[model samples]
Target: MTATAAFEAWAAQHHIDAPHIAIKQTQHAGTGLFAKQAIVTHTEPLLRIPNDMLITTKNATHLHLTEEFRNTIYQLFDGTDEMHLEGKNERLFLKLFLVHERFVHANDSFWKPYMDVLPSLAFFQENHVLFKNYAEHLAGTTLSVSISAKQRALQNELATLQEKACGWLDQITLEQWFWADATFWSRVVSLDEENEAVDNGQATHLALVPFFDFANHSLTPNVRWQRDSQDNSFLLMPFEDATIGAHDELFISYGAKSNQELLFLHGFTLSNNPEPLRLRLPVTPFLAGPSQPAISRFLQQNAMEPFVAFGYSHDSAPSSSSQVLPDFPIAHQLFASTGFTYPSIVLMYLLALDEDDGLRIDEQENIVLGNKQVDAMDGVAEYTSQLEHFKVIQLRVILLLLDALTYHHGELSQSIPETTHPSALTNHIAAYRLEEKHSFECAIDALALLREELLQEPVVIQYMSSQEQQ
Candidate 1:
């Protein structure tokens, strides 16, 4: 039987069925489910897979492997407090289980049909960032940076897993592990918390659901999946408002994910993906600013825990922060007013404020200026008499954004490969970068408007005139 036919037969044997949907090959996404006939929104589920059939870390342990091998797998899977750390241990266990089933057990394995249909190791080597071949195409993009880090992480973890191995795991090659990593990352879904009772002692948070994994992703998905707690199965059904027509491809939203995430994890990029542009401010050291010592101290004090005005130290800080930027009501106001990322807005404050700026970190670690500790909930004057002071902050922010966005756009432009016959991967990299470029342009345009508004302020005009005379 063909791979698809065998896969369907396997699903049927496990009691998975979707009469209204059939698997079909497509120009993109390889194989996806399509509507066999017009299907309306209904109370009945389109497809269901019993909880027992889910290929989870909980279920894989029962496989007929050597006692030593099974013990090793158990130790590795249960040893980490970091199991929740991006599901690393869980995925590693699943990857090893998959390799063992496909190679060691081969045709005798219960999951042989599913294994036959899993994408080959060669497919991931050519397409995924986990492999070195695809990294060059992603150079100068955030995903490229992530690709480097992810490869390092995988190698480190793979080494650790191998160190803990016995028997069959010794036979698994690095190439097989990489392929299994790709398979798990692309296909695994987090089981719903509501279905916790139905896990049947598997107690695993992640699962690779049979047949349900075939539906491709869409931003405006026609279908949604949920754990049918009462039925002890995972259900795929049309959304209440959706009207799926005959022959139309079925789609389920992967989640509201960014292009970088989609490309890194799933090996595909969407055109005009609506995920917000992630703008991370590059950390520049505060070497000689008038408030450098004070700012540096504040950053150091709260470096371990996030809070407004603290947490981002001078030497090295992440491109983003979860803290609220304290006082300077104008700075706080600009954050909501300008939809800029919180870290960027906070960085603008650091650049604009000085020792003489009257902003001080009080004994309580609350940022206060002139005896007023402003917060998101507190009331303060609508406008300050220090208009010239606030104008400086706004102008500095405008210049910083313009320069950063322009430089980033230039880097992206230069890194794009100059080829007329671009492959799908190249196109995906180009489109992903294109969305970031567009976001940069949009921010630049908004900065211009902000600059124009700043010029209109009387205090700003007087300040500029005074500086010009100097």
Candidate 2:
């Protein structure tokens, strides 16, 4: 039977009598759901999947298997077989592995029809191959390291499972296991309140819903879904009047995800993702200066990390909130208004310093520890007395950030040559980099403007200080 016929048969077995949507192959988006008839806005559910039909870890536990097989699966699930992955992730991998094994090896396996329609592992493997082959092209990129870490974790899990499966060891290849992992990564849905109760909260409940996974993503989605508490089924409906005519594809919003997230998780990048790109800078280096010991102690006492992330939105102002900082209202308001965090932290550190310690410029134009200047304020109260010190710290922090941004911009520019010819792979990489470069440029411009504003503040502070003295 053809793949569509196989899927139809599978749907029929599950009592899905009449689906309003049909699966169609697209050149760019793989398989997606298309409307079979005109769907009105807020129409009744397009599809309802029964609870028993859903494949989840809770349901998978009920499958009858030999004690040895169960033991091996349990070992893999606990990560006692390996040390890196979490127990929850191991359980997920175990479920998918069992599903794939039963589908391929057992004629009596109930999940066979469902498995037959899934896109081959090679379909998803191509993207992984691209990442491996073009590693250098993606150097200095935030996503490259993340992808590498995932790949490593996947390989470790697969190897652990292979070592334990003595009897069925030769039945599956690592490639097939990789495919199973990808299947979980792409299609698994998180359980809502109703479904969570069924799992007793022992583990995170996730399931694979047949036919429902075919709806492609859109930044602006027309479809909405709800989990039925009575029957434990999921109901999909149109949020707005379905402008989708017969044969038009139906789209669902995957939430407001960044382009990088969409690319890695869904294997596609949005041309116009409105979310900002985040750049992380390590605070450890900054903490190494002599006067920063107290700052480090403060961070440790508060259980904060030595890193700060700057989010650069193409169309909005840069955001300065650090996940590491405590959320006191006054500090939060100040940080948000300034549109930067590191500078404020630096300013706070400077204010905390004893008057005996002073800041001096080094040969490299970097701030360094220097001999005490008697003119420096002597105490916390005195520091606050001259509010001009706040502007001084802000100016210094802006200059430091500008230098860092310039370095990153230069690195990204030099990595890709101007005259390189394009291929299919190159085109894909170029698109990803274009978004990254755009974000960097936007951040640079925003920072430059902020520097100008901050420069004027110091003059004002000095004038105000002189006026106060008079």
Candidate 3:
């Protein structure tokens, strides 16, 4: 058998779905990683990335050096430059590595001379800074660890990146503007509280996992797991209950739909060849700013604890005669805001109900059933459809906000907090951990406007009048 064929066979045995690439038999940039297919809202896609693909900080560095970074080293150092190495492998590795940006480099002694010469090119040049700073131990010796092929330099972290990006933005003149900076903030909006926590130790640990790398970002994903060996790691699987189509892009999202497939999909689909046909999962297009919140933390903190007394557990309680308690101002305000508010409120309740228990669909029509205890598919549909009535009202409010914000501040609409649920959510004490959320100035303005509009209602007027008389 040919050498590549032999390798392919071995890779297949080792559980590589795309054995051709593993065996170095072919390159797959043209084929792409996914295919076209119809996928249900929750379903599993075959795992293309095996656990083996999970490059560690040490191994990743080694791969960076050996896999393809050789040329840059050879050109920059081997000749009269600085690193005068005489070996064949040294020349070949350096030559190959220059072409491959993703190569993992591991030789500190070898890189030291090159670093001494090329001090200003990149950080960690002379002192073996790469391994000395990022990694604790490699081969039982201290080694510079690359987090993954993606972050070879170990420079970017979600929190730190946000800080640096924002700082840079603040320095820019008013005429200078960039959307990429704003996009980073969106990722910040979705970060878990722990990921962004300040008190957490290990300053350089918050690695940003690429969203497209995982390919799925749902509120409730199908798979769930924690790695048996890796510290601070978890695995995801698709939900067993959801059906996946042939060409859909499968993603591991935040959803805990089933114990079987740790998967999450919004407008999700399953497909055999998903790269070309995967459905567009629900992602807010807006640049995540202060207006957008880290919702997972927000929901966890605000959701009523099962056993806690509703009126007394929180400080903002109201009298018995009150239709809505002060503590539940958001709940009270929902119905009064616009024509769509009622149905939107219903959908929120329905999603909460399904999420609280286990959500299931009817065996026949795939109709969503709430709490195996209650078959409320028709009710859900009615509420979901009624939301359509608010389309005009929603568009108008958005137009008003945009027009107002634009006239007030000579820029196009920066963000629309009032249109979203997370921004509208009050009683958000958790968001102020350590310091108040710096991302919510626009959202706060939106809420103040909403509250002002609500206060004009006759019900609020009557409520205030009665309180004044008493």
Candidate 4:
């Protein structure tokens, strides 16, 4: 049968109601679901996919296969080769392998119709250069680290799988496995809490819901989904009082994700994602010398660690109406938001002592030894007197961050061309890089504003002693 005929047969076998929606190709978004008629607000489910029809790790465990095949699959699933697969989940990899196997021998497979409808490997391969440049340009950012780590893990898994497959590796290439991985990451949805399988609690239980996967993402989605308790099926419903006009494509929210995350996972970026840009700062520099033990103890006491994150929203897309002042108190606020309290703690330490004194613990009480003058004052008074010093340190930190942002912005700005001939893949990569470049530029601008704002603060005027006034 033709691919469409196979899909229609599969939908018919599952009793998919076809009157409400139909799958169609869009000029830009590939294949997506469009409304056949006006879907009323708060209407009943547009689609209900039964549990048995869902492809999941739980289902994979029970698939009928030869003893050798099952054992190898289990070994891969268990992740016994820990050296290569550290900190990676094996279930998704194993499930994809089985799906690939089934697709190869389609005569005996149950999911041929669904498998046939999946986009080809070429669709994902076209963006290789973009992903490569993204990794290179965003070298130190969290998003870059995450992408690199995942790529490494995928490479290791494919190597191991290929080795174990013995002569069968000819059937599925590493590229095919990558395509499956991308498909799973982009389209799979977690099972509802009420429908979660027991063994899959630690790992999120996911399934590929056939027609539901076609709904493109929107920041402001008009539709929501839930599990039907009665039949153990997934039910796609409209968000409260939101109506879908006739011929309007259905859209669902993928949660409040950052542009980096959207681009990495879904191959697209939102032009106006409201999440603030965050910069991760290592705490190792602050923990050198005698301060290490004291810093460690302080972090232990406060339930924190050696890394801290600082972030700011650009005025153009402020995460909130209230602006965050770049001041001494902002460090405390940063501590509260991220568990990285080292910045505020280090500032206090610097304030209580002269630079020559260094950080030393008192023999009597494990307290940080400092200039006896500040130590004589009460806690609040001591901190208040150090405001100017703290402001100076804060300025230094902001400048360092701005320099890093400027470096990334420069790298990205130089990588893409001035223009490109319009093709689907080139257009997509252009849009993705544009969003990334814009985010970097916005962050640089925000940091420059913060620097200016900090320089204007009255505390920047060094405090003068009576002797100095002579």
Candidate 5:
């Protein structure tokens, strides 16, 4: 029997219900669930898998994980925040469990039918952004930068696993570990009560629900998945009044994700995706500048509220002597999709300011303060508010941003080859990069209009006249 047939038969034997849906390989996309019969909306669920059958951390422990192995895995979670413990490496136990089932477990293993159907390591290396071969398609794009970071993190995770789980029974090759991770990220879903219940009673918030994960992602999904606690299963529910035709492919929204996120996580990119591209700009020059500390201190004191509102606030601010800039608390990286991403624009604005423009760091108090001690300098806010200074700072900020965008966009443009026929991976990367460049172009046009308006301001004209007279 084929893999899908075996899985379907396995599901049927296990009481998983899906009377009207069947899995099939698509013409363009990979394997997906298709309707075997016309189904009306608000009717019976298309598919349901009992929660007990889910491949959760708790479930994995019960499979073949020894008491000793489970204890070591639990120790890995030591000192980690009970509430916020989710990342590439945090679920090493689950990945290790999957590896055991895939390699060590025989036909008698309960999870054999499902684990046998998962895509191979070669498939992931060819498709996933985490691998060097596939990541080459995203060269010169911000997604490539993200891919590199994730690759490094994955390697770090491999080292940690090798160090912590020192044994022969469960110690798998890095390739095997990577496959488990790829499968988990691409398939797992968090239970609804995850955030609230993870600390107290919940053993795990995430689960790989078989069959249900076969449905592909769509921005305009006809069906949605929900945890049916009453039924003790996860249910795929159709939207009200949304009729699905016979043989139609089922789709579910992966949430409002950007091209970078979709490419990184799901190994796919949607052309003209409704979400804006997340552009990660190079801030090395700004970070290394002599005024970097002052700029960070200024934003920390005067702009912490706005920074916090933008979700960029760090748990602990970096020391002034630290070379890292504080505004980009995560990685000292700047991510912007539009001129209106206030945090990016505000950081650029501060970087563009100087002592002449009323930016001063008071050593005595170790805080940023406007130079009211200097000639006619009211404060940093007041100095920038003046028409002449306002226009200059605005112009400088625009140019600084435009320069970064142009550099990245040029790299993307150059890396994309000219060919009449291209592979699917090439086409997808080209489309994604073009869309990102479009955002940069839009921002440039908006800044141009703003520049013209600023030049025409009465205060700007008056300041120019005074400068010419002097």
Candidate 6:
């Protein structure tokens, strides 16, 4: 099928209910899931991982077929089964969960190169049992057919994808790398019956969804939640007083991200020689439905509260058995300085149907919509005021980020003497006349994007070298 026809057919088949895929000519970002009438933060469910498809393992490896692994895959599919010969089974097993273009057009190894840079994946393979990236995301990872099998007519294009997927697994397996606390660890589960675990000790495969793929990482953002003792169905709406632009990306502290993963992706170099300074905060905002008194009193006292999420252990000990999302007091201290915070939740939604779709929210309750429960899709009326509250909190966070800067000139500047070299820091004197300029610029950019107002903002340079100005 032609690309347009294919995309439309796939959309229709998968349940893309929009009138058509809206393409933006200017923005580098590919197709975006558009908003019909200012979609506000109702915390409506979007995409999700199926529990049954989850193959939670202690570690993922790619060593050449070990005797134990071979036995397992053989027993699972009996290994020699001709079904592995490729055909619909291969596509259904692996590619079905990936975006149609990459799945059909790329090799399995094709994804490995892409996966190669993922700190979380690297950390998991090398360090932990398993890690995930983007519980919901686009074609971040791909699954290809084992090329030795039957050749599809689209081999040159899609076959390459298949090849890449395999190559990716091989290298990671060979190196035994792993990533701990980044979004790379958590994957949205795709339900494909044909894709079963091969006895050969390969990392269990996962699926990725497109729209829910917009999540970006941050040390902080507005919004918070925790499971209430009485209310199992955690409805995460924005704070009543928060402000949001028409098109801002609503991110709150739903989950804790790994510092190792953060270091890898954002280029933050953690000091092995010196530990992060410990911080203490007297007050923290309790989540909406506080089961514990500790979090409750903190929230009650703090005017603006920002909660925390626990990243995985760097030591690689057996992951904390208790699944309870814990708070990081240090993170809260940073936010308490700003006056915006409330209790919130890190919710996990799922795909209930086989088709692609979104839901409409009538009441403040969960109803099955589309293939998953998209949090942003529930009409804005229910949470507009709260979202605005979130926006105000976000502004305060941005200001805090600005306060962390060292500006010397009208331009922006950032120089971490430890992570950066003397030369790099020296070079920036021309750009920033005042110490605060650099931090303010970064915070501005960071906050603008979070508020979904990236379009109107001027280009704020967080780190500009002296030579670049010439």
lDDT of 4 by residue, 1-470 (tens): 77766786778687765557777787766778888788765768877777666665565443334444555555655644321221135445444544455456456655667667766566666543224534443443445555776777777877877675554444666566666677776776667443222232353555667778888888677777788779877778877767789998888877656555566677665656665444444455545665457546656655655554544432343222222223335434422222123354344444334343333466532434343322321442345335546655555655655665576667666665544445554555565566555555555555566567667766554432322576
Evaluated with lDDT, which candidate comes out highest?
1
Model 4 misplaced stretches (Cα beyond 4 Å): 16-19, 40-42, 61-69, 77-99, 102-107, 127-146, 160-172, 193-203, 276-357, 360-388, 432-434, 449-460, 463-470
lDDT tens digits, residues 367-415, model 2? 3344322232123223433443555554555566667667777777778
Q: After superposing candidate 1 on the true structure, give the runs of residues whose Cα lies further than 4 Å from its correct spot.
A: 18-20, 37-41, 58-69, 77-88, 99-108, 164-177, 193-204, 285-331, 335-339, 358-388, 455-458, 461-470
TM-score of each: 0.76, 0.73, 0.26, 0.71, 0.79, 0.26
Residue 53, model 3: Cα distance from true site in angstroms: 3.4
Candidate lDDT (C-alpha), each = 0.64, 0.58, 0.28, 0.57, 0.63, 0.28
| Local accuracy of candidate 5 as per-residue lDDT tens digits, 1-470 | 98889999999998899998999997655688999988865757888888778766545533555555555556666644323445433355567666766765536567788887777787777677777765656777777876777677777777876676556444567677778778777776667543121211233466678898788888778888777769668888888867799999988877767666677776778864655554556555664456566555554565442221111111111111211123332221222322345455555665677766666656543424363432221243344555345666766676776676677668877887564556665666677777666655665555565556657877667767876999
Can you write out model 1's per-residue Cα lDDT over 327-354, one digit (the tens) per residue? Answer: 3344455433233645446555555554
lDDT of candidate 6 at residue 373, scale 0 to 100:
32
Supply the TM-score for candidate 6: 0.26
User: Where is the poorest 10-residue window by lDDT in model 4?
Assistant: 317-326
Per TM-score, the best of the predicted structures is 5
- What residue pairs are clashing in model 2? 41-241
Candidate 6 per-residue lDDT over residues 1-470, each given as its tens digit: 43434443443454333331221211322223232234354453322212221222211121112343334334433354422323333323333222311222234432332232223333333222122231111011111111111123333434443443442322222112212112232333222222221221233333332323233323343332222234222222344444545444444431333232322232222222121111111122222232234223323444423432211122211112211223323322222222122122111111111112232332334333433333332221123223323333333334333332212112222322232332221222221112123223333343344435422233322112322675
Error of 1 at 398 (Å): 2.7
